[model samples]
Target: MKAIREARGIGLRRLAEAIGIDPGYLSRIENGQQGAGNGTLHRYAEELNVPIKAITHEETPRDQE
Candidate 1:
């Protein structure tokens, strides 16, 4: 996520404004402090021109092995 954002040269504030979310919220997301819903995930995928799967992925439990 940070890679995509930085690749586009967009700041957190700009992305938050474009997505109609709070910059603080975006900051939390970027820092792995919070999770985003499907809608928010799609919005970011659209804005970044990246696949939604790239931004939102399922976390495999350690016990799966």
Candidate 2:
């Protein structure tokens, strides 16, 4: 997520503001310390001008073995 966001030149704060999420929360999400819900994923994709799959595909299952 951070890679994609960086490639698109979207700053953390800017993306967070655009998606109505806290910068810290977004940072944690990007850092893999937190997970975002479907709605948040949609919000990120909308703000990033990418598809939801693009956002979702980047996330791995948290408890994957």
Candidate 3:
């Protein structure tokens, strides 16, 4: 998440404001100490200009085949 944010040239405070979260909370999210619900994931994707999968780790059935 932090990588994507940095790659997009987005500052912590800027993204936090855009996503309606605190900068410290955003940092925690990026650090993997916290988890985001589906809605928050959408907001993060929208604010970071990335797909939700970019920050999530869901296993697809294809990988098990």
Candidate 4:
């Protein structure tokens, strides 16, 4: 997610504003400290020009097993 964002040259503030979220909240989501709701996820995917799967496929600690 962060990789794609950086590759697209999208700033945190820009993406957050596009997705109607707080920049700090978006940072938390990027850091895995918070989860984004489905609608929010869709907005982010659209803003980043990526599929929802790209953002949703994050490997949680449990998924490592």
Candidate 5:
């Protein structure tokens, strides 16, 4: 998350505005003090112009054949 945001030269305040979240919450996310749900995560990806898959890169795999 930090990497992508930094890559785009976006500040936490701008990202929060783009994602409709609070800057404090976004800061918590960046500092690893909080975690966001799927909906927020997707919105972050969209606002940051990155693939959803990239944002969810650490998602656990489902059990399947």
Candidate 6:
């Protein structure tokens, strides 16, 4: 996510503002400290001009096993 954003010449604050999220939260998401919901992921992918899969891979919850 950070890679795509940087490639697009966008700063964290700018992308977060564009997506209506807090920059610190976005940073956490980017750093993998938190997970983003589908809607937020879609927004990020759309803003980065990339497919949603590029940012996220569907996963089975460990607890489901």
Please give the CA lDDT of all the candidate structures.
0.86, 0.88, 0.85, 0.90, 0.86, 0.89
Candidate 3 clashes between residue pairs 3 or more apart in a chain or in different chains? none
Write down the lDDT that model 4 would get: 0.90
Local accuracy of candidate 3 as per-residue lDDT tens digits, 1-65 = 88899999999999998988888988888898987778878999988777677888665787578
Clash pairs detected, candidate 1: none
Per-candidate TM vs. native?
Answer: 0.82, 0.82, 0.83, 0.84, 0.79, 0.84
Model 1 lDDT tens row, 6-47 = 999999899999988999998898789999888888898899
TM-score of 2: 0.82
List model 4 lDDT by residue over 1-65, tens digit each: 77889999999999999999999999999888998899999999999888777889877677689
For candidate 5, the TM-score is 0.79
Candidate scoring better on TM-score of 2 and 5: 2
lDDT, candidate 5, residue 52?
Answer: 81
- The sequence of per-residue lDDT tens digits that candidate 6 reaches over residues 1-65 is 88888989999999999999999999999999998888889999999999777788554576368
Point out where model 4 deviates above 4 Å.
Answer: 58-65
Model 3 misplaced regions, further than 4 Å = 59-65
Off by over 4 Å in 5: 59-65
- Tell me how far the alpha carbon of residue 32 in candidate 1 is from the true structure, in angstroms, after superposition: 0.8
